[model samples]
Target: MNFNFLSPVSDSVLAHNELLSAQVLGRKLHIHSKQNGIPDLDGVSIAILGVLENRNDVNYIGEEFELNEIRKSFYALFPGSWNTIIADLGDINKGESVEDTYFALKETISVLVKKNIIPVILGGTQDLTYANYRAYDTLMPMVNLVNVDCKFDLGDSQKPIKNNSFVGKIILEEPYNLFNYATIGYQTYFNSQEEIDLMNKLYFEAYRLGQVSKDITIVEPVLRDANIVSVDLSSVKGAEVSLKQKYSPNGIDGKEICAIARYAGISNKVSSFGIYEYNPSKDDELTSMLVAQMIWYFVEGVNCRVKDDDFSNEDYYQKFITLVDEQELIFYKSLKTGRWWIEIPFLSEVNNKLKRHTLLPCMHQDYIDACNSNVPERWYKAFQKNCL
Candidate 1:
């Protein structure tokens, strides 16, 4: 509860919210303000944290205040069937160094997540993802991260931490809690051959930008099994963001990224999410609105969550078994949501974290492929990672 690092929301932003109607989000939000102090989180399920730290970014390098633009748009929107309470925890300013900022963030994240209040962070740099990953160290024995980015971001682990190299640090760092790392919308040209080979060698998952664009729903299965979802705003096209400094020409479109955000929200396992690399100076009305909608969609998904983990209860799941290459594969389809999950056999001798949850979210096609004597790459990868 020691949120001393958090600064109160600006009077100007609060003034804007005052003008809105009672039905608007601005009125419903429990904002941390100078007059009212940090809002009570008795029933809040989601907290919006604006992180203003970017000294380590490799691109658009500068220090300035953020969150006003994004909050202006996010607060103006109308809520849609959401019963979950949201709090604007204001912003966490940069510290003496990047490590200091990380310490503040890690502590803040740990506090919110332990209370089961998911933190939807609007961040300074994508490298803050390293801090986000570290926040979950004591909360969960293992973690599954899904990053929506144009590049794999597996920069040299030996090098210092930067926007492009945070993922490498997470992989090589101590208390290796990262169980699985998946990259969605990675453009091949943006990543080097060495990093790509390393991703394969380590059994990490990477989905090409084309593969996601071709069938965006395929990402749902990947996200459904994830515990942490981090997005790099630079993955958005330059045209959509209306900023040339960080946006790329070829990447996830605005609508697709919002859809992915919703998918992440719907996952019962996903506890933390951050949209990083947002440049407030370069942002326009459209840019803020896009980010705001992504947040809205995520909140909506959280409200629609249903607990379908009890596969032992026959009434909730349709169990199916298939054989491929003389190996048996079991799949469970939720009768309520039609979501599919494959069973990874329990190994008592293996790490307890890997055995904590045996079900891995997968697609219907994976089961069909198994029936056709073809291995689902998704299952194969998880199997390899766990067995190793």
Candidate 2:
């Protein structure tokens, strides 16, 4: 019930040489600045907790990655109105139990909710989602949980909290009927026929990866009704969540994943959000960059959806037609970093006139780059000139 962060983490510990520094998009509230928490940002508060350890990946020195650089990565990804506050869980050993982590997260979430700010949990593992939900349980008797993961994560084995058993623990511990939970993007390799049978028996709503690819729009209704969203970065194919568990060479590309994140963020019912399993140790430069991009798109989705006016286009009511006529407007299929980009003319004026705020242009660039792969630059230039 009472809120406290694991005491004032010693200045030296919090301020290590590797802790990189980058300006966040919104107001920055260092926990040391105000113990009572920022009173003003009750509606939308942001917190980034680096739970950067696991039973399997124990050798990893969680803090080696510069915090400021990581922050900068986020800055480059999600550009606007981010009330950023960050903390690190350090290397939580097997002795350092999930319950304690849950306590810390609960206290933090309590404070943010009291102040009306949205709380985001960056994960150490998928198991953290259970801790997040446990924290949620302390506040409300019932809250919907949407798990966007590549696996069903429900196995009969009573193994230590590892890669695939997180959802199983939740379902068994907390009766499925009591909570509205849906599993999306479940791949074949992750689940067994028995597991699938159990899920069907339990009447759990599920969408396989093929189904997701068929039409991502159906995910809209699932998210729209959920109270909390747990997004496993592994669910995304190209994500750099784990070196050992990496799904690279094949996975959902960056852009669609961003769109999914955006939808979850804008889900009005979504009070809490989480992105898990970011094993930076295995990640390359591009991996963090992609994570950053996804974060940006999520924020943009929230901003766009929550804003009073629609800004899909500059004019509120224009001749609504797909303008990509003869000239193919080059845009990437997925917004990856270092992709080609064409300037969109009249963008500033349109944004200003429409009263729309676009966050993290880097993400937009990723989108532009991906789509433009097929489309020509000259067409883009012409489109830009016409729009201007």
Candidate 3:
């Protein structure tokens, strides 16, 4: 538990916390403060951490930011009927270099993950996700990342990593822990044709902004299978956030983004969650409150989680088999939660990246599509990736 890199929460926020009702989250959380120091994480289920580094932002102009506003908004909200213990471990201030900040964040996340505690990261820039992804290098054999962003952020990995280009580094970097990467609510105009083709060529998943807005439920299965979930506040619609935080006129609305966060939290496989690219401004109250509610929904979803993925017992799930284009598709439905899963046939002969991901979380629509002799796009991509 070497959290030496972490700075305690500010005294002003603590003063604000003192005024909050005892029933609110601020009073209930195990907060790391100046007077109290770091709280013991013995029974903590989730830890809130903030990163104050933003040099990697392509638009960086030597500006500093803080998470106090977001913290204030979060603290004011009343908690739902929940049993999960949460800790506010405070912020990691910017180091001498951006890489130094990344090192510190990587170390902090690595320690938190190894303890089986989910780190709800409030980030300075989306590129911090690269550090978060790297934290999983030694912890797991393979990783699946789901980014809720408007752009793919697949910038040239050969150059310096920016907030928009970190994904490229994740894909090309060594240790090669990233097995799958998916983008939800991606706007096509923001991405180049080459990046779009590259995503398809790599057999990765990308759900369009329009498609996701039309049906947010489609993302449940994607999030369910993911190990790391990163959200860019810029993905939220311009009208839904503060002027400084707005990126696109068209994007996921506040409720939709929060729903996606809840889905990420409810997923049994999702180990680490991050909300990045927050640009605080003078009138960022709306944005701060939205971020706060998103966290609240995520914590709420975590409390509602059930062990419905265990397929060992016959009573827990029901299985179905169908044929499409001579390809046998097997589906499993959880009796406990009614969630669906489609099995990817393990290729014993090939060196597979998805050795542990044989059962792919799917939707009931996928089963219907399979029955109608159509292959689900997710299954096809995952199956192809497994073969490669």
Candidate 4:
């Protein structure tokens, strides 16, 4: 309820919104403006927030940016045939220090999540993701994060918390609530060997750029089990984004990124979503439009969500059992959605962190792999983490 840290949307954007057609999203959303303070949250399913903090960027040189352009692009777009209500709660300006900014972000997102309202954050730097993770500390026992990035971002925890190193802080910091961390579209050259080794040792998931581009559906299961989904714009290809925002020549394309966003939206567990590392520029129209499309696809997916994971009703899902290496694997296929899940046996005797994560979302291929006598990698990793 304490959103004093938020600033109203810019006057220019509001003026532009007035010129847009009534059918666009600008007219549909309940917006925060100078004239109308904060909008009522009653029946609001999604809230859009912007955070203006990037002092922690490793390549920072005292440059500042704004989210007005992204807002304009998002507002001008047409909405899908959806039933969810959205509100733009405006932006959070930079605080006295980076930690102060993080605190404000944490508090704001915490309030939204507690109300069962998903926050769609447009951010300055990806390090804000650490604050996003912290927002869940009191809400959930353990958290699963799905980061769509080109790097592992597991910098030295002893060093200062830079945008590239915040993940390490999340893992090392007190009140460890992180249950699992996964990275999608990771470029091998961008990550050091030690970070890759550490990821393997930690039993965290990492999907290469080529792996995801080859088949985007691989990320669906990973996202299905996620509680927070954070995306870094730098993971997008140089040709697909603005000059200032591009970081790689080979990365996820605009279409693929939008597909990933839609998958994130469809997941029942994903409560908070963020797209970060935005660098506004004069020639950022293309990037802004792509970001808008990504948001649109996410909203579309959210409207299509189905409650197909309930196993209490025997007729809702069909169960299958297979054995590989003398180990029994149980798989369930949703009769409503055709999605699959593999069961992770509860280790009641051992101190288990995954007592609540018994059903692991998986693909049909995983069932085929188990039928061929090969243990699915996702199931193996989850089982290993549970035993740890």
Candidate 5:
């Protein structure tokens, strides 16, 4: 039993009416209570874990866990058309130090992911994403991470890691498995010019808030390419979440964030998901319910996921090849889901951990760009990263 790594949800949090309504998810969730044992993982597709540590946040002055409030709001909501078993593993209280909490989270998430159970993390701070990424170190050869936030958070690698600088640690740390990092809804005023330039120099992708709000569907292809998704509630408008940081007056609204969450859940490559920077206050109910709805959309997306990775079987996909810059660009569209992918030629032997995949996820737009003789930057970056 990994019970040592977690604490049962407080009795007060589960004090809801026993009456089970078909709509209320609290009635159906296998919550980890003091009396009941841990839920079986046999058919479970998603596990919810609450974390109560935030010392690493750049603005940290000490904060309380929003778990109970979040729980109250989340449990009261209705589930969508989902058949997957969802379990609440309760909360991880603050450890001795920030690193101590990081250790607990890393160790805990590592085992669950190894078992192929997707963990939907209710987080303390965005810095915990470093631990989320670390959990996949030995499980996979490389990783593709997507962060939904208003800042790149690419603080100095030379300094101690904080919520704003965890990405720098992920990039410079050992067992380097990060292949791609994409940011959605980044605002120009929040990120420094150097950090912005660093993104381009490192070949990472960043979509401005206006770009995403203009075309919400554009985020799906990016999420489809990610392995881990970390979302900062600060990315949402302050009017929506009453954000602690008060970071942005302009941000993605409630609907867009949930859409992004659903897209993350729909991605076949996304193994673990996290929602961070939730600071509970007088208006906790409003923010908590919004966050809960986002989680619901993710669960709905998971239930609606369709497998389309098999390109070897000619019957499963339609192939298209276009010549651009004297090089042949190959694309595959899933016959079942209509999703798209582009082939990045692998020069080495097949089946190697690093070579398990050569096809990078793309969108229909990429094919159109290729047809117009414009080489897709994403394809080029993936090609460069793989060949090196």
Candidate 6:
């Protein structure tokens, strides 16, 4: 029998330490420890956490990727880094129970954030997002979340621990505001209208890629204020390729997908990010290579932002807003003096012309009143400011 799954670690020729000791492109890595002979990145708190094993026996596992393959790929793409990737080899299927994975994830995240490290998580399923959010609970007072997926993953969990609707349970239980969350690339077939309606009712931002394919420029401002980003690979495509989803056909492509990932990474506000639904059995070598490339670009975006920049918030806001053109879409910029006035796209009402800005933060209730009422005339006249 192929007893590679004997335990979390193996005592074979290619020891776990030997496999995980590869370097990243430009940065030096530090391997922390070798528990059970599985190599942990030393001094490198930032991580790419992959919950590949689950106790629920949910048929989520497809084919597993070789650690050597992933490590070598990372080294080729990022040559100078000492250690940027690590995997948990614990026998996730020891039983059909929740296991200590959730606790381990929570502790791991706490350690990284405390040390100012960014964690790039890969999911066994969408359930990991809930655990991730929970990890950040005490650390972040107010969090802005961006979800790029085909479905809301909000099915009723009363039946079983389904990945479908676990996020719903999380939102209902957490004090976080729905408006702070944005769901991008939603497909009509994957989600119910009721789910969509529920999202809108909760004031969550939701965008349909069916309507905005090339106009993804609008994504800039939407995420400019967000602190967390979670991605589901199913949102990209479901094909037989190594990295594609099993059920999705209509989705974004590799290059365009990377652009979006780069966007999120460059935002600098992102504390945590994830990619889900990768089946190594179904994945092509090219697909595996692309996964490594995507991870590289993610780190590239992270390194681009400087920590001590003092650019006025207005500067970033204006720059992000300028990314959207009025020629293609009729969006009115709501400008309030001495307060942040975000661009609100009246998309559903606009001749169905402009790409909708979903999950965008509207100003406070008072500002909303002003934007809705005739107060703009007084405010406009008071400040000799021109509305572009």
| Cα shift from native, residue 11, model 1 (Å) | 0.9
TM-score of 5: 0.95
lDDT of 3 by residue, 1-388 (tens): 6888999999999999898888899999999988889999999999999999999989999999999999999999999999999999999999999999999999999999888899999999999999999999889989999999999999999999999999999999998888899999999999999999999999999999989989999999999999999999999999999979988789999899999999998999888899999999999899999999999999998998989998999989999999999999999999999999999988888888755548999999999999999999999999888887
Cα lDDT tens digits for candidate 2, 88-165? 322222226556665676666666555555666665667777666666665666566788887777765477655567
- Over 219-301, each residue of candidate 5 has an lDDT whose tens digit, in order, gives 89889889899999889987777545345679999999999999988988889999998888776777888888889999988
**TM-scores for the candidates:** 0.97, 0.63, 0.99, 0.99, 0.95, 0.67
- For candidate 4, lDDT tens digit of each residue in 1-388? 8999999999999999999999999999999998989999999988999999999999999999999989899999999899999999999999999999999999999999999899999999999999999999999989999999999889999999998999999999989898899999999999999999999999999999999999999999999999999999999999999878888799999999999999999999999999999998889898898888888888887888899999999999999999999899999999999999999998889898865548999999999999999999999999998888
lDDT of model 5 at residue 340? 92
What's the true lDDT of residue 345 in model 3? Answer: 89
Tens-digit lDDT track of model 1 for 1-388? 7999999999999999999888899899999999999999999999999899999887554657577989989999999988899999999999999899999999999999999999999998888889999999989888899999988889988989999988999988999899899999998888999999999998999999999999999899889989999999888887787553346788888889999999999999999999988876554787788899999999999998999867878999999999888878999999989999998876688764564658889999899888888999999988888777
Per-residue lDDT for 22 in model 1? 86
Give the alpha-carbon lDDT of every model.
0.89, 0.54, 0.94, 0.94, 0.86, 0.54
Candidate 2 similarity to native, TM-score: 0.63
Using lDDT as the yardstick, the better of models 1 and 3 is 3
Model 3 scores a TM of 0.99
Ten residues in sequence with the least summed lDDT for candidate 6: 378-387
lDDT of 6 at 325: 22
Q: Which ten residues in a row have the lowest lDDT in candidate 5?
A: 349-358
The residue pairs that clash in candidate 5, if any, are none
